[model samples]
Target: MLTKRIIPCLDIKDGRTVKGVNFVDLRDAGDPVALASAYAEQGADELVFLDISATQEQRKTFASLVKEIARHINIPFTVGGGISSVEDVAPLLEAGADKVSINSSAVRNPQLINELSKAFGAQCIVLAIDARKIDNAWIVHTHGGKNSTDKKLFTWAKEGQDRGAGEILFTSMDHDGTKNGFAIDPLSKLHALLTIPVIASGGAGSMGHFADVFALAKADAALAASVFHFGEIQIPELKTFLKNHNIPVRL
Candidate 1:
């Protein structure tokens, strides 16, 4: 059986790791390199570093910070934010990112997905969709969950897969930073619709929440930030807990 993955997200703004509720009221967490190294030591399956303001500022990702984090961690790392074209992906991969996640850029020009898949292969491209429940439907949000796109979550995910994206990182804006629980209802709906691996993001408060996401949400992986960054939860211990609960994990 394929073991489920636990991922830690680092939202960097102005070169510092930060966290916020529903993508607002940001607070500094720590240095990106230090946090990446710590998560690596904790046996996190993967790490996602999103330069939250890259697109809004009309700038590329932080290659310097990427290099800094790359120097210390050996695990698979994904870098995202403001990545529009193949050119933007180069610096990130050069800085040692195992995968490049595209959100706003891909939503604006979906062909960017085909181009990335052609240039870097599907496995190297990750399509990240930040969604929020709107009137009983999940609407796709872009620009660090600040703007909404016309496409729905399911349609986008299916199209992303068709465009050759290897995986989808689906985040729930409502549950984000709430530390209540993952939005399993939408996650399960998306998981059932997509064949590509789904990485669930937002609202991971406890080990039981992770287990709930994996079991009920049918997510291939769960991604969280505040809990792990603030030391509220430990990755290895969480893995053992998942294992004890009969969840398939790399313990």
Candidate 2:
């Protein structure tokens, strides 16, 4: 089996790293460049830097910060927020992002995924899906989980894969920042239905929660924000705990 990955997400807003509950009530975390570099040194498999407000604010990503953070880390970094087209990805890649994540923009134009993949490569694109449980099914949410779409989560995942998305970063809006645990039912369904990697996000409360997501959800990777940002969970220790649980992980 491929070793599962542990990734730390840096949600940037106003040029500072921030964390929030269910995608609101933002609070300062730290300097993104500093945080990214620290995570790299501490053994984070990859880093996700999301300019959380870009979509809502209707602006481009924080290129200055992206460049700064990229310069600080050697590990692969995925940058997201307001990335709308192939042109948007060029500067991000040139700025040193290994991949660019698309959320609201991709939902708005599904074809954008195909264009980006063709222009760059499937390996350079990651589809970030934020969804909420609605009427017995997971429904996709856009603009940082503020709006729900008619599209079903599973269908969207499959569509993204068909469009050549290399990976899916699945985050449950209901579970985000709750620290209760992951929404495993949806994650498991996604994992079984999609061939590409699924990165489970949200509600990772403890070391055991990490174990549960992999064992139950079958996620390729697990991502968290507050727990890691506030020092509630440390990357190396979490890897060790996963190792103890027989979850394949890089330590």
Candidate 3:
């Protein structure tokens, strides 16, 4: 089996790394460049750097910041926020992002996924879906989880796959920052429905949570923010724990 990945997400707002609960009540985390370098040295399998406010604020991701972070981290890096078209992706790739993630923009123009996948190849197009359970349905959200969309999580994820997205980065707004656990049921469903890798995000509070996401949900990767940012969990130790549990991870 392919080794599962552990990714640390750096949510950027106002040029600083931040963390929030359910996509609001944001708090400062640290300098992203410093954090990226640290995670690289400590053995993070990959890094996700998102300019969290770029979409809501009506701007593109900080390509300069992406460049700086990429310079520091040797691991695979995915950059996102405000990416909309093939035009938006080129600079980020040139700036050093191994892959580009798109959320609100992709939802707005599903064709953007095909265009990006065609232009950049499916290997580098990550479709990020942020959803919240509303009235028992997992409804997709946009503009950094502020607006509700008619798009349901399962259908939209499958549509994204058909559009040639390389991976699905699903963030459950209901579970985000709760530290309870990952949204296992939906994740498992996504795992079974999609052939591409699924990167599970939000609600990672402990090592056991990571184990459960992989063991139960069959998620390809597990991503977290606050736990890793606040030193609540360290990547090397987490990898050791997963290795002991027979969850394939790179230590």
Candidate 4:
């Protein structure tokens, strides 16, 4: 069986790491490069760096910051936020990102997924979907979760897969920073629908929550921010916990 992955997410705003509840009222976490190095040293399987304000600010990801963070970690790093085209992806990859995540741009132009997958190979493309449950259906959100679109979650996942996305990073806006748990129902559904790996993001409170996402939702990976950011959970401890629960995890 493929061992599940534990990823730490760094939500960046103003060149520093930040985390917010329901995507608002952001608070500083730490310096991004320092946090990345710490997580890598803690045995985190991967790191996700999101320029949380890039799209809203109408600018590209800070390549210099990405390069700075990349130099400290020897793990796969995925970068996102305000990435709109192949041109935008080159600098980040050159800066040391193993993969690039596209969210708002992918939704605005579905072909962007295809173009990116083809340009960099599907394995290097991660489609990030920020969604929330609305009227019994999950709707996609953009612009740092400030705008909602008519697109449904599952449909977009399928479309992204068909367009050659190697993985789906699904963040439940409703459960974000709640410390409750992951959105298992939708995660399971998406897992069943996609051949690619599905990364369950948002609402990770404890070790049990990680196990639940893997056992109940069958997510290939679980990504969290605040819990891991504020020392609420440690990657080494979490891995030990998952292994004890018979969840395959890299120790």
lDDT on C-alpha atoms for all candidate structures: 0.87, 0.87, 0.88, 0.88
Local error of candidate 2 at residue 131 (angstroms): 1.1
Query: TM-scores for all candidates?
Result: 0.90, 0.91, 0.91, 0.91
Using TM-score as the yardstick, the better of models 1 and 2 is: 2
lDDT of 2 by residue, 140-236 (tens): 9999898889888999999999999999999999999799999899999999999999999989999999999999999999998888777788888
Q: Flag regions of model 2 displaced more than 4 Å.
A: 20-29, 53-61
Q: Write the per-residue lDDT of candidate 3 for residues 1-251, one digit (tens) a residue.
A: 68999998887876667764222222323577777777888889999988766354434437677778777778899988878888889998998999999999988899999999999999999999999998889999999899999999999999999999999999999999799999999999999999999999988998999999999999999998888777889888999999999999987
When summed lDDT is taken over every stretch of 10 residues in candidate 1, the lowest stretch is 20-29
Model 3 misplaced stretches (Cα beyond 4 Å): 19-29, 53-61
- CA shift at 136, candidate 4, in angstroms? 1.2
- For residues 143-183, could you state the per-residue lDDT of candidate 4 as single tens digits? 87999999999999999999999999999999997989999
TM-score of 1: 0.90
Runs of candidate 1 with Cα error greater than 4 angstroms are 20-29, 53-61
- Candidate 4: global Cα-lDDT? 0.88
lDDT of 2 at 43: 88
- Supply candidate 1's per-residue lDDT for 4: 98
RMSD of 2: 3.8
Question: How far in Å is the alpha carbon of 171 misplaced in model 2?
Answer: 0.8
